[model samples]
Target chain A: MRLIADLFLVVGAAFTLFGAIGLIRMPDVYNRIQAGTKAVTLGSLCLLIGIALLYPAWWSKLLVIGVLILITNPLGSSTIARALLKAGVKPWSKASVSQPGEADR
Target chain B: MTLTLLEIVALGLLGAAVLLSLLRLILGPTAPDRVVAADTLAVITTSGLVIIAALLGSPLYLDVALIYGTLAFVGVVAIARTIEGNG
Candidate 1:
């Protein structure tokens, strides 16, 4: 049981690390939001579950946190994306990168 | 009070994750980019808080994690709405 819990924790941490890397490496805010939200949400859930396994008595609190993340993470990311669009932020595209002069128009 | 090897590795990975996210938060080119980084940082922090609770062998920290997660979500939504400029 302890071994399984450790595996979950390690895997969750690794996923979170990937999400952060994506946030840094992605070319635009949209990509960064997608990477950060999806990966980190899953990572967090895994971490919570692992913690619950390690301490079974804490399952109720862990479940609450997990559910909160599941709902809010995606909702928050979408809200940010919508806000960015409303604020006139353009999404990055291959065409924009390939034809830099065209992007200005 | 000693951590097992796996716990240490998990902690290291989470620490690296936090550093990377912080780098994005600092270097992000625009407001929305920074906001996204902040949101990601909040989620990571929530998980990290839970891990800390486990490490400390206390249930009290779980309440902290819960409250932190709730407040972070509310804060993010408010920031996003302000950025949207509907008002």
Candidate 2:
């Protein structure tokens, strides 16, 4: 049981590590948000499940925490991205990802 | 209780990842980038708190994690609203 819990924790942490790396490596603010939000959200879920498995008594509390995270993380990220776009932060363009719009233009 | 091998590895990984996100928070090019990194860090902290609760064999830590998760969302929303209104 402990081993399983540890495995989940480690895997969750690994995903977080990857997300952080992507946050740094990706070009532009929007790309960073894209890389960071999804990985961290999933990683947190794995961690919550691992903790719940390790401490069965805490399952109910962990469930609440997990649900809150599931709801909030993406909502927050999208809000930030939308605010950024509204504020005129441009996405990385043909110089990086090669947009079809740029090709057409 | 003392740390076990797997917990140590897990903690190491999480700690490293937290540091990585902090690096972005420091170096992010724009306000939104910083906000995004901060949001990621907050979620990861909640996850770390859960792992800590397991390591400590205490449910109290879990409650703290839950509270922190809720507050983190509020914080994000407030920041986003402010940025949208001002920036």
DockQ of every candidate structure:
0.77, 0.79
Error of 1 at A90 (Å): 0.4
Which runs in model 2 stand beyond 4 Å of their true positions?
A95-105
Model 1 bad stretches (over 4 Å): A96-105
- By DockQ thresholds, what CAPRI class is model 1? medium
Worst 10 residues of 1 chain B by lDDT: B1-10
TM-score of each: 0.93, 0.91
* Model 1 CA lDDT for position A60: 88
C-alpha lDDT of residue B35 in model 2? 88
Highest DockQ among the candidates is held by which one? 2
Estimate, for each residue in B4-32, the C-alpha lDDT of model 1 and write its tens digit.
Answer: 79978989999999999999999978878
Candidate 2 chain A TM-score vs. reference chain A: 0.88
lDDT of 2 by residue, B1-87 (tens): 676788788788888899999999999667777888899999998988887777778778888988898899999989988888886
Query: What's the C-alpha lDDT at position A20 in model 1?
Result: 96
Per-model clash counts, in order, read 0, 0
TM-score of candidate 2 relative to the true fold: 0.91
Predicted model with the maximum TM-score? 1
